[model samples]
Target: MRRLLFWLLLFALPSTQAAEELRLTNGEWAPYLGAQLPHHGIASRIVAEAFALEGIEVRWEFHPWARSLLLAERGDRHGSAVWLSSPHRKETFFVSDPILDSTYYLFHRKDRPLHWESIEDLAGLRLGATTGYDYGEPFQRAEAQQSLQIRRLGSDLLGFRQLLAGRLDAFPMDKVVGFDLLHEQFSSAERARLSFHPRPLRSDSLHLLLSRRIPQNADYMLRFNAGLARLRESGKVSQYLLEAQRPLSLGR
Candidate 1:
């Protein structure tokens, strides 16, 4: 009876299953990624929910943009979240399906009134670029060939400040990120001083980069893409993005 009761009690107890966790390196790029933002911002939220559908949890390690890439490349972490796809990156990592879209514009001070219909138009002007960022193929080629005068900076905020100070003629930045920074960091008067060219520098998709060093990541990539498709089909992705924009609008 005692042995039977022991087996019965074991069967009666609830089962505890440990969830699978994936660690990804991250950086602060607000409205998309920030350690303090709700769900760590929209992109992070989407990535997490997609993985959740596949019964995996995400653990994000916050670092500088360059360091984040380094950690992922070295396999110190599982991968990096929210990076633009590039040929170099493709060689080092397995790029996932598009997680978000980003449009780049050349931001300049309103007083300067910069005009550029093509990459060659602004050749002589001082341009500010963030370190470890991809501004697109045309811009990259121009910079490499010394056709454009480019200055590499540490962050987007610093690049914008350079533009306002007249040190930089223009800075390439994401349209949404540029405005968000202006709204968050500058006064109304300061905000009024900044503007972006109507023409976009480039439009690119953001993707999750899983490390090539991890053999299992190949499988993870397949699972992530499947889960993402389901999330999109359910219309939750658009709903969540629309909801995120509401707070930004209210703050502005």
Candidate 2:
């Protein structure tokens, strides 16, 4: 009777548990996702607020882009933010709804003008690309076929440095990120010397990626998507982005 009473009392007790904490990987992509920016930039801000709406707390760890993906895929972290989705990533991770949009542009020196209607036009020209970055399937195919001369650098900063040094003819980078980095890292004269082609290379959305190695992340992605939708409906996502883009002293 006592044992039966104990079981009844246990079942009657509240089943509610503490909200789970999620560890998410991030990288330094300013005005979007960065460790130094206020609230770790707009994308990270949106991620936190969205998860907060669902009663999940997030802890962020910043690393290089490649390492960030590795950690997430291994489930060392719950997920990573702001990655362009690809087939391999889709197979390995549960991709969330688009958190931000990215537009790619071919950046080059103003004095060294370049015009191209297609990938073939870029043959024999020196181009800089970042390691572990996929511009697109078309660009990839061209590089693989040896139709385009490309140099892979470790980061966008290095690519820009190569362009500035006249060692690279062109570098493809996100329009927003290119401008943001120029403003933050270069002098006024340096910024003036560089420009991006008016024609965009491509446009893609950035998404949060949760590892498939963790079974709970499948459910997390659903909750994240739902919360993201709410944030979008509330118009806070746009609001956050506009606020982040505002110019400030020190460019933090």
Candidate 3:
């Protein structure tokens, strides 16, 4: 009886330790979260360090955003980063405090002579959006009800092409991504023809989304928030941004 009890305790230890480990799912979208060679990106680095602070190990899997979200939604994965929190997602997962702030800008041709003060201002305009891209509650709701002419494109680059060809009147995209795409994919003349609205459609906080299925996620959430606070206090967050932005600035 004593020997059997000791063997049972030994087996339980491994399972307990495994439960504390975290598995993160991400997609390859550059300048935010991507599956680049050495490491994913700055967000992944921040996530890894935050988990490390709490003695948690993180592993990542790269997939399409839709599939990645589905895995996390079903509790098949531990969590995901750089996701916008919305009422739609609150039921399936818990979101950490905002890890970053993102701005959604409307891009149009330089010759279009259109300006948008707000999302409502764009009503009836043919706007393009990337499939599976979440802007915010108001915009998403508007898009769903067909109040706006939102065309779903396969990729951001495609949307840019459509806009230039007059197929799409305008497209909504992140400022960082918009600049990157313009610099990388557009010719000098083409880049000059593209312009963005002076104001962003909206700005929102981005959070690290954790699966509720993982019993340890509550504790992990606390650690992530605490770690982020520490980074902010130490000014590390600003430093990280400066480093990440260096390459983008050099090209200009």
Best by TM-score: 1
Highest lDDT scorer = 2
The residue pairs found clashing in candidate 1 are none
**Which tens-of-lDDT digit does each residue in 169-236 have in candidate 1?**
99998877777777788777777777778899999899999999998999998999999999999999
Off by over 4 Å in 3: 1-20, 246-252
Q: Give the alpha carbon lDDT tens digit for every residue of 66-161 in model 3.
A: 888889888899888778888877877889887777888888887896776666888989999998787777789999888888989899999999
lDDT of 2 by residue, 53-90 (tens): 99899999999888998999999999999898989899
The residue-level lDDT of candidate 3 at 44 comes to 76
- Best of the two (1, 2) by TM-score: 1
TM-scores of the candidates in the order shown: 0.89, 0.87, 0.83
How well does model 3 score by local distance difference test?
0.79
Model 1 lDDT at residue 228: 96
Q: In candidate 1, how many Å is residue 112 off?
A: 2.7
Off by over 4 Å in 2: 1-17, 246-252
